[model samples]
Target chain A: MIITKKSYTFEVSPQSVDFNCQITLSSLTDLLLTAAQYNAEENGFGLRKLNNNGLSWVLLRLALEIDYFPLQYETVYIETWIEGVGRASTTRNFCIRNKEMQIIGYAASTWAMIDHQTRRAQDLFTLDNIGDFASEETVPIDKPIKLSERRGVLTDVFSAKYSHIDINRHVNTMRYVEWISNGFSPEHYSRKSVKRFDVNFMSEILFGEEVKVYKTEEAGDTYLFEILHNDKPSCRARLIFRSEK
Target chain B: MIITKKSYTFEVSPQSVDFNCQITLSSLTDLLLTAAQYNAEENGFGLRKLNNNGLSWVLLRLALEIDYFPLQYETVYIETWIEGVGRASTTRNFCIRNKEMQIIGYAASTWAMIDHQTRRAQDLFTLDNIGDFASEETVPIDKPIKLSERRGVLTDVFSAKYSHIDINRHVNTMRYVEWISNGFSPEHYSRKSVKRFDVNFMSEILFGEEVKVYKTEEAGDTYLFEILHNDKPSCRARLIFRSEK
Candidate 1:
């Protein structure tokens, strides 16, 4: 039987750290996404193989919670596995641990496979034996929520450029996370660390396309974001923070 | 004697690739910077150790020339070593090769050690025996040129957010590199591939600070860039591209 669960180890390099010498959220997300891709490839159902079949995977939603962010040069491991697979989507869960094997964070994400030409969802279960790898286990956290559509205060406006597009020919998922994460200030980070983050990608932002990021404070500690491409919604997210001081 | 030269291998992951499935320049620069930090730490002058003394390393100028960019999932190696160390700056060089060990690219960079508190350049020789690692060698490519000041066309404007700042409490070098690289559209990349890139960081841009990027096309294929932070020149760069068609 093919191994469904896979683990990858990584060191928090200097390039991943932020002003506090701790790993930035975007880099952490990168690590998680990397682990997901690696595990999918190990199972022989990765993006490369799917691309050959004229199909592509798109992230639908993601949620992450960290106990404490790791510092620069610290080694960490990420173990990920498919929790469940349905006709339209699949759930992948991750466990993040420090060098000592102590759990530090967890993440859960949902993905959908789509037809490359139609840009429409394809039945994910149709992939031969992809369901065989489902472990039916989940991380110790709330599932990624489906964020509501919001048209908040326009905070940032820009165009997707060459640097923004990824292998799938659209803006990378991590760049969307970055745009949402950037809505807050350094002071907010110093005073509070993200306890939970939920993001939903609705559409793809393409190269040379204009983008507008809207931000709204829904509560004392919860913030919501909507990213619009050419005035059309592309992604939405919510971040929950806990006071550190 | 401790080994001064070091090499690290990396598999180009999905997160690092662009629309063409080839590694992006920013990600490539990240790999080079990662190698520099790893080698420095291996030699006992790493940032973690420097942080204890309120000191840190900063890139001053860098120039990279790639024969062909590696594609996603391709294994590549980067070997780096200190070319020389002076009072205020040090020269480091890199060689990039594919899995078959064929040389594909070369990069040369200049860096300085600065007191984190005062933010002033320090005599690099003051570090214990750091000069011992200087190989006094040079790469085959042209050195990172010292670009002259230019008031070109304003290309991009944005505020440096928390995500832009690195462990040094200011905007990170790679972020600045991305901004400069983002100035050109995808059509430009589709037609031309970078032959050489040179960047000089003149001043630091802190969080919440607004920045403006300017571009000037000189005679031939050379393009010059000037990055201003709140109307003050912060960085400058030159990119030379070769027609791929």
Candidate 2:
């Protein structure tokens, strides 16, 4: 199936950045959702209204690999496509770009159309009653990063605390990034900088779950590490720091 | 000690709400920071630029009281002040309002000052070089709400799945609201209106945590319930539905 590949572009803004002076994970999630909504609208649905059946789409899972992050005021684009339905879930892909069109990051996610009355997963093909929104580019799930051999220059252990947590039952992805970067004694949080980070969830981290982070130097001045859940891999990623000072 | 009460206002916009149609937790955090920063700057200290010495202010704890959320295109005002300063923390309070000047919500938070080189918490008023940030209202922390008895109208056992969590590593607050609403068998995720809700978090819920919910029908179509953790209160709230769908 050829799913229409739709894309969205946004410029990095100061308000979107964090105290660390970097775009936050929450913002990234918004970016992904915004892009997905764009594709959904192009296919005959948008956020402004419910479907013909009064149902709405909800997120399920997200996986990604980030090579680098665009700095503040740098224009970034997100290209998205539907990857066909698999059993109950539908997959989508996104590519992050800079003003120069460099691919800074890429991601894939899955969502379920839920029935508003039944509170159950609704069949995506019949979701909008418009038949299957044909796609021009039905892609496969993205190849996940090999999380083995995790190493980085800075590794720290953190436990989920009431203050650092969010409304989600899991560690907010952006907060994890913020905490991990903060583990660094570096001075980038307040500076204009560039960053690249990727993390995958393995074991569910709950409130008060203590986890250790392992970091080792990687190629291209990137630091790679794995968030270990009781010595097992919870999430692994490589973060490229523009300035380590 | 009369602490000077400082204030600022921001208009609520659609973009401020996330996919869930709620003013995000981060928006609240940013609002708190804005109020605090204003007071700091008025105290003659540039919170952003500390002469490159790197001493910075960090958030510690925050308690917000939101009785009602403003609708789209509404102008909301936020008034804040440093309630007091302890050895390691400074407490601040935020009062929210609509154009009518009715108190819609309030939040209290603690901030800690840290030396950039040490990355350790420092005494709140120890910096001799620190500028004048003063407040007129020196108050104590608002006593957190405690859960109590309620009537029973609905019962739900919800498992905290991986996707149901956020970075704070617990159930996302808004998602909890969403899910509790989801628990309504007669209504799925299609409620057009949420009249009023008061949720008090008792115990922290984590990833993979399962909650047993009990609801009661209150007077005038309001529903009261408590999310229980091991039979104790994790979150308790009364929801009034205002949307006439």
Candidate 3:
């Protein structure tokens, strides 16, 4: 039997670092997604296998909390496993550790398997053995919160291009974080660092589709964002920041 | 004494692969840049050290030719060294090898030192010991072509956003590649793979500035691109593609 729980190690590279020399949020998301993919492949039901059956996996929601962001050239260990497998969705949890093996961050993500052609969620029951991989263990952080509708002011607008689309013909998750992060100016970043992040991916945005990002300040250091396509909500996010000392 | 040459190994992760399961050009470029930064730091003249002295390095031109793209999870090695140093710029060469130690690709790049504050090209001779790092070797590939001005048909237009700007406060080189690659649709990519690429950076693009991309067919399989800002050329590229069999 293939193992479902897996751990991977990586070194923070220069390309993944930001102006502050710490790994950027997008890079952190990439690392988590990479680990998820590795675990999926180890369980005999990866994107490659799903694509062969006219299906693909899509991230629906994610929440991350980091005590400290790793710096360039620092070693990082990510232990990931399936927390639960439901009828049409599943949850994956990650433990992010530093070189000292101390827990530095935790991330949890929700995903859905959808038909590649119809783009409709497929019943997870069809995958007969996927449940075998669920360890039923959970991260000690709150689950990704369901973001409510936000009718905020328009912050930016751009059409999805080739780079935004992934193999499944939808926008890459990190691109969404990039759009959200871009909502702030350099001056804003100079004084603040992200503490926690929550995002809900309600719908898929395809290539060449125009996307408008809306932003509103919910409270002190807390901002909410809604990404709309053709006036329909596609994704929502809430970001909490702390002033850098 | 610092080592002027360096070798690094990396595994092509899922996030770096494209629809064909081969590593995307953008990800490959990121790996190359990462290796360059690592080698520079090992030589004690990295971006951090240079920035401390009010100086920065900027990519001027790059050329890459690959025989086969690596697949996801495949191990690859990159060996890089400074080939030559001139009055104002230096040439860096890279050898890309697959897990079997077979050479798979070769890349060459030229970079210039500039004042961080003035953004003016700095005299390389002023860096007393930089000459000691030149290996005086070459990558056995054609040098990056000096692309002449091309008045191609308009392809894409957008305002440069904050995410496009790197720590140097200018648009990142990979962002330009994205724009140029997006000029071709998914249908185009389905039938062709890039055989070689050459890009030249003539000027820096700033945040929130309007930019346009133009493209022209040079011959049967060669295409030229030029990126303009305020009607002035910022960067140019030439791509040669081979029809996938």
Candidate 4:
């Protein structure tokens, strides 16, 4: 039997939770990506197979809408499936549920297959029946959108260290999320919870490169962030928060 | 039968590994801590129970001696048990085994029970029969020792951010390990793998506190690290790496 979609269960460990006792955005993102990996592997197009062919999947854009953040030791079930496949990119969607099977969040991600050596995007159609896995499913939220460049106040500046680099020799995606999460103070997090998060990866940040994080407060509890390396924007993200009350 | 020791298995995930595809020290530390939590809970002395009494366990010192780092997707079994319980602190030890059931590493950790409100250490003897759970087991490596003050070149300086803080409102121990790991570059990591790691938490680093990390190269593949906040040492660590021949 061919499986087009899959669900994975994860328990929120003590370390993954924040001061509020809820799971942090970065750790949630990790679970989502882990689900994607598992589903992809089960369908036979995972990173291990792609790496053997000198190719790998790279995330381009991601947007998550979460209604409730699961607390520490809570179990979350993430269901993921490929939504569509195009020549240039592919889409994946997720549905997150709590222990009671209540749907609590939705996420959408875009990815592209790239030649590891050339760093060029590969045609999705070239793979053997890769499109067969697309379920044509859609999430309730809008697709991840590109953010326009806006100058913001510098929030942080630091050089990429060894810990930031991943197996791909580039900065890990979770590290970027962590930096964005750090832009807000603990007091801000205490009063507000993240409702929506959208991020777009523009370029790769290599090791030893200095990174500057900028933040601009948008209207209505929205904040924009841009990560720059050598004056080039490497990633941009937007976070929307809702008051706890 | 009452269980005095517990064994937990963890599969190294994609996101928890470094550029070498091996599990990172921070992630390994997380698993050990997780094991500790599980064992404590089963024995009726876990954080959940302690939190109900306005108290929690705080890590004081840890030492890990690893013969190999498990790669991504590799399964590792960690057996943990309480070694002894003193009036002020408790000792816990761990044995790490790979898939073949061969011992790959050992770790020892010291922890103290502290009142959440006063942030003062409490008497371990106060807990009902907490000392009965000690198995008196021992690991081969030396116990976690107190690192002396060493002055070295400043490697990194930054303020504790929101992401660095944990549920206790202090910088997470994993972040401290990361900062110490970041003291070296990719080239250094490519040439050497950590053989032993020892860390001492002298004080807490609260959110927004400026932190300065210093690294001193010692004799024979040894490096010492010190983290300071406002000219006061908050943490000290030692790393010994072996050439990957």
Candidate 5:
């Protein structure tokens, strides 16, 4: 019998940590994505298989709630599985545990298959027997919500560079996270740690494209961010922090 | 007997690859550093021990020669050991092997211990029993050399940001590699792969510092780079590429 749920362990490297010696949000996200990739590969729907059909999975939305950030050299176990599959998209859930095997975080992500040539979302039902892997599992937190538009203060504007693009020649998800994280000062990170983070990818940003990042403070230690390309929203995110005190 | 020469294996993750699906220079550099950290930790001279004394290891120079770039998901084993120890610094060398156990790359790095508060280099001999760990093994390539001033064309200019700084509140080694790699276009990377890369760090760059990157094309597929902070040379590097054809 095929295993529907899979867990992968990663040790937080020195390069992945920030000044606080805790793993950065982008690195944590990378571990989650890495676990997703490994699970999908084992289940026969991996990127290599999809690429052969001119299709690839694209992350549409993700929401993560963390109780503690893993420190440098700390080991984190991330378990991932498919929650459900829809005609247009699919949901995947993740459970993050510390070295002691205690659950510390949960994440929910939505993804869609897209054609490489057309860059259009493909029908998930076209994939053979993909729905059979759905575990129907659910995380405790709410699903990644649809972030609305907000005319916030412009924090940064720059052209996308080579380092920002990944193998797909599009702005990487981690780059977006890094840009969002850069808006806050180191002092802000020192006193407040991220409690919850939600992001929605609307459109793709290509290399050399001029992009803008805007951030607005919401009530109760919440901040909303929107990244735009040529006046069109490419991605939107929300970050909620908790006081260390 | 203490294990002085150690080998660590790493699988190239999807997030670490470039558009060509091969690991980028920055990612490769990170792996080398990670191996160095592991080896140092095992030998009882790791960052934790150094930090306890208000001192830390700092990279002064590095030179890497690559015969191949490992593709995504490919496992590369890096064997590292201390080559020598001096009063002011130490030399470490790395040999990278592919899945078939074939040597694909070798790297040499020099590091110095610095007092965190004073930001001054301390004598390496002060570390108890550090000399006993030296294996005196050397790679074929020349040691990392000091680069001279070059009036190359300016490639990019930007201020150091939060993500650029590491736990030490200084610019990360990988960031400098990224910046140097960014000077070349995707087309350049597609046609040519790195053969040798050498970098010398003259000064540390902190967050919010305005930095300028300059690139000069040398003879026969070689390039020189200089990064400046406040019109002073902060770092210099050289890259030699092999044509894919």
Candidate 6:
């Protein structure tokens, strides 16, 4: 078994969340972003020292599956790696665990190479020569859930900071949910409850990267939300809201 | 009414809970910690920055009341003020909100100033000239609930990071809950479910602060937990475990 040696772990607290006990979803995007940073730093491609030629990896989508949740003061580890990069999108994966290293949650994100200054998506194939970051076998891609199924509000934009980055890697998916969900007024939430939210996690969003979250309330019953790394989509979510508050 | 100009809100999430939607007892401790940061920072006694001469505020106790459960992303404010500095402790208070200025939750915390290097309680009287973070007004303090009434694990020592700090001041409460709750083994949680937890919000832990979470499991029924800042108790909590996996 290929064991994870340093599964970037760190502690996070309540101020981390919007109003929710869970980590915010956008924070999740930030986590994915940090995971990329960790991977990049290990490969000498993360936040560059002198030039400040930062690496900004945009989240394409995120698919999160959680078994049990965590509480405040608990320390967690985010283990991630490049499943491999492809011609179009670079696929990254994540797993959140406890001190015991038990998998508490997992996420899969799709990222695209982008120019830091221009804020333009760089073609992965073209950048293989310049950037030291490259992958050999692009194993599997987390297939985006088909359009025929359910659609809710996808998280649109997220406000982030440098601290959101974990020394521990990636911001954490729950933070993304919190940031995206926070867009909606809490007063509205009490009046409206989230029944089911389907968030397909794609890639990671780094710290201090201001992300725009877009959501199209579909059919007046559910909403389809998308968190974008500029024009490229990062995470798409479908939320079923109820009138409770 | 004195209002804070730079106010932030929150949307509580599922991650804040143990297995139940209720916030983990640990989160209450985080809330207290967060408020303490504000109380300290407003007076220029913020987090440890550059110098060894830093004051690490430790939590003594907390009394909180949840009038109505604050759900995920339910916008709430931790409106806080100091109630003067005692010989050993600084009193802090907070009120939660649902939306814009809507009171939803309320809490109060007592903090002890300590020397970061020595890890021993400091003389609050020395800072007497500064007085408490807030004026001494007889604000109501919530009564502490029985520790047995709470749920979750007596958390064990867990490592944390500096980036966990938020713009507001300390580590957000939700992130703490998420990580701390995640500290337990997935198998342990899958085997024994979290029933209930009640935490007393304590003192704040700022950036670059390394803290330890100590837990004591009692017969798998309840766990006594404490988040120690530099070995001094920052917060206290009680968690209830259930028969589930």
DockQ scores for all the models shown? 0.84, 0.05, 0.57, 0.89, 0.80, 0.06
| Count of backbone collisions in candidate 1 | 0
Candidate 3 wrong stretches, greater than 4 Å: A1-4, B1-4
lDDT string for model 3 (A98-192, tens) is: 99999988999999999999999999879859987788889988999999998698988878877787888778888999899888876677788
Q: Which candidate has the highest DockQ of all?
A: 4
Order the candidate numbers by DockQ, best to worst.
4, 1, 5, 3, 6, 2
RMSD of each: 1.6, 11.1, 2.3, 1.2, 1.3, 20.6
Q: Residue-wise lDDT of candidate 3 within B1-245, one digit each (tens)?
A: 33368789999988777666778788888889888988887787888899899998999999999987898889999999998889989999999999999998999999999998899999897886888888888988899989999978997887887677777877887788888888787667778888899999999988778899999997769999999987889999999998973
How big is the positional error of residue B43 in model 2, measured in Å on the Cα after superposition? Answer: 16
TM-score of chain A of each: 0.96, 0.58, 0.96, 0.98, 0.98, 0.58
Compose the digit string of candidate 1's lDDT tens values, residues A1-245.
44479789988888888777788888899999999998888888999899999999999999999988898889989999999899999999999999899998999999999998899999987899988888888787999998888888999999898788887789998788788889988877888888888999999998989999999897769999999999989999998888873
A54, model 3: CA deviation in Å? 3.2
What is the lDDT, from 0 to 100, of the residue B100 in candidate 2? 89
Clashing pairs in 1: none
Chain A TM-score, prediction 2? 0.58
Compute the lDDT for candidate 3.
Answer: 0.87
Q: Which residue segments of model 1 deviate by more than 4 Å?
A: A1-3, B1-3
Off by over 4 Å in 6: A1-6, A18-20, A49-55, A125-179, A183-223, A226-236, A239-245, B1-84, B87-245
Ranking by TM-score: 4, 5, 1, 3, 2, 6
List, in the given order, the native-contact fraction of each candidate: 0.94, 0.00, 0.47, 0.85, 0.73, 0.09
Cα lDDT tens digits for candidate 5, A10-114: 999999998888999999999999999999988889998998998989999999999989999999999999999998899999999999999999999999999
Question: Which CAPRI category fits model 2?
Answer: incorrect
